[model samples]
Target: MTTSLSAAELANLVTAVPGVRGIEPGIGSTLRAIGSRIRQQDPRQARFGVVVEAGSHRAVIEIGIDGSRPVKEIVRDVQETIIRALSEAGEHDDASETRQDSDSSGVGNRNTPQVTVRVQSLL
Candidate 1:
């Protein structure tokens, strides 16, 4: 059976990766967090830099790196980690090289979620 990962869970996993400083909070995430707090909801439940677009089966992640390793290497690790996590979640593993840009990496067929990693800053 296939399972879906929440944005918060994905964020947690990304943050745990070595050399990952933290999620780079964007304006949307900040506003969502503030709104959640104002509405008496758990702020932690608010989406951070990781955004999972269910309709498109795409995961967009923005992160701040610790700069201990090469940026490209760190980005690749992040992409691979996310892909592994998604695969473990019962997502299909029809791997394909779908490069969206120089910094982003997307793998898998249409049955799997495409992961896009963006390095927002160096910490």
Candidate 2:
């Protein structure tokens, strides 16, 4: 089952990751727009940030982080986390349907949102 996550839900998920301070300015609204586009994912997944299409179910995320962590590592972690979240949401949304075995991540499904993380500042 494919599930949808809202901006608040996405934001919460992002914030839960270690080192994330908060979203950069103007980012919250961008996330909200993404969330609106995914209104069908899961109503319950509406507690955090949202996903939007930036050409192809893609979202660009701008974040502020703590300067203590290694920049490369933090970026990697964010990528993995968002991917995992999207995968889980997709699985949930497709829970009732039969699935095919493939190497593609869940986000690769039709119209699945892709996330872009931009570290605006290390505070």
**What local lDDT score does residue 39 receive in model 1, on the 0 to 100 scale?**
97
Best by lDDT: 1
State every prediction's TM-score relative to the real structure: 0.67, 0.64
lDDT of 1: 0.71
In lDDT terms, how accurate is model 2?
A: 0.63
The C-alpha stretches of model 1 lying farther than 4 A from their native spots are 1-3, 28-46, 91-108
Among all candidates shown, the one with the greatest TM-score: 1
Candidate 2: which stretches are off by over 4 Å?
1-3, 26-51, 98-113
Residue 73 displacement in candidate 1 (angstroms): 1.1
lDDT of 1 by residue, 12-113 (tens): 888888899999977766676667668996443457686655556667788999999999888888887877787677434223445445454444355465
